[model samples]
Target: MIHPAQSLRTFIGSKNFEESTRFYQTLGFEVKKINPGFSLVKVSGNLCFYLQDYYQKDWCENCMLFLEVEQLDAYWEAVKILGLPEKFKGVKLSEIKKDDWGREFFLHDPAGNLWHFGEFFD
Candidate 1:
């Protein structure tokens, strides 16, 4: 079995590295490397977003990544300033319904990847 504290990594397939890099950069990711067919963007400590060239068989549906932040409104505001699409449908700051755990909202990236941002108001 895998340890709970073990670091996890995610890879995203992209046909265009420049566009992918720019999109992630708008979401506050720092570009760490840029090559002809691959690029790395740092999301946080020990967490990086990998963008690889898309081939016919290598392309797979991208996965959703969640980011936890303290302030949802401020973060969303900054995201707005970055010119990301506000395509959030059923999620809002005022109406953040929480489960037994905490409150959360989801934002969809240009590549149809969902990013959940949650705050634990416990």
Candidate 2:
């Protein structure tokens, strides 16, 4: 017997491609292609996010994307250069404590989508 395959890709709805592209780029994602009213962002390994224009008031109400990284400090520093919300104030770089599971951080996209950056140390 064979187990079911894991997720192949995640397609998300977006009303603003330009803003969404910028947001993902800030998180280290590279654009794979751009078509009419749609854009593809490469997140990792076989994971890709396809953003398409849609008519919805709350598209990300129950959606969240988590990215796994190797180094939290370096990734955080790079994101800092891209600018973050003031809520992150007083959060020292070294103070980025790691939980029992791993190191992580939260961020909001321009379209009000919540994202989590997680790091697994072995």
Candidate 3:
């Protein structure tokens, strides 16, 4: 039997390093700079990823992340109130939609990376 891993981290690419960092911070994620070109972003203690000041159009556009939240409706409301789409170029937000598995809202970052904020049915 395989043992469970302690933690897992994904590397995310950013087109404009400063803007991307600011974007994540604006979304309420904690960001800790590692160096000039790389940083760490955390939504919670156990959930985090590496944000790199690097970009490949194909990779950035195709990348997607699904983040499970406790209260998706409230989260969506907060996101809407932020007016991210108006503040950041290329940012887009979608209404909450229900599917077989759960309900979710969509957000596309400035780099065109898609994020699904969802809540699974209990």
Candidate 4:
């Protein structure tokens, strides 16, 4: 039988593929280059996505994903190690906060894709 779903990765767009690749690299995602227009970025063992070169206004604007990390605080701190907030001017992020469901935070990549991070309470 085929395996059930385990994880997910979203393919989002980038106006400038090279710059976007660098942005994700700074976010601590390992990248495997396919071409000038495409790359596969592994966020973790089971999470990865294809970064494709595309710039249709509506499509890029509509792209978004919820990324589930094991630890929100550590993830944010490691990302901060890259100084990505300084690296990307006017970058956006949300503070870590917990609700009934889980603790979570958010950040926006250069391609304008919104990534929300969350995990269940211990």
In order, candidate lDDTs are 0.62, 0.65, 0.93, 0.80
| Residue 41 in candidate 1, Cα distance off native in Å | 1.3
| Candidate 2 overall lDDT versus native | 0.65
Give the per-residue lDDT digits (tens) of candidate 1, residues 24-114.
7767788777777777778878677777666332233345677788887676667656545543222122234466777776665544555
lDDT: which candidate is best? Answer: 3
Of candidate 1, the 10-residue stretch with the lowest lDDT total is: 87-96
- Candidate 4: stretches off by over 4 Å: 1-9
User: What would the TM-score be for candidate 4 when compared with the true structure?
Assistant: 0.83
lDDT score of residue 13 within candidate 1: 64
TM-score for each predicted model, relative to the true structure: 0.69, 0.72, 0.96, 0.83
lDDT of 3: 0.93
lDDT of 2 by residue, 95-121 (tens): 355789888877666555556777987
Ranking by TM-score: 3, 4, 2, 1
| Collision count for each candidate, in order | 0, 0, 0, 0
Model 3 Cα shift for residue 45 (angstroms): 1.0
Clashes of 4: 0
Ranking by lDDT: 3, 4, 2, 1
Q: Which of candidates 1 and 4 reaches a greater TM-score?
A: 4
TM-score of 2: 0.72
Clashing pairs in 3: none
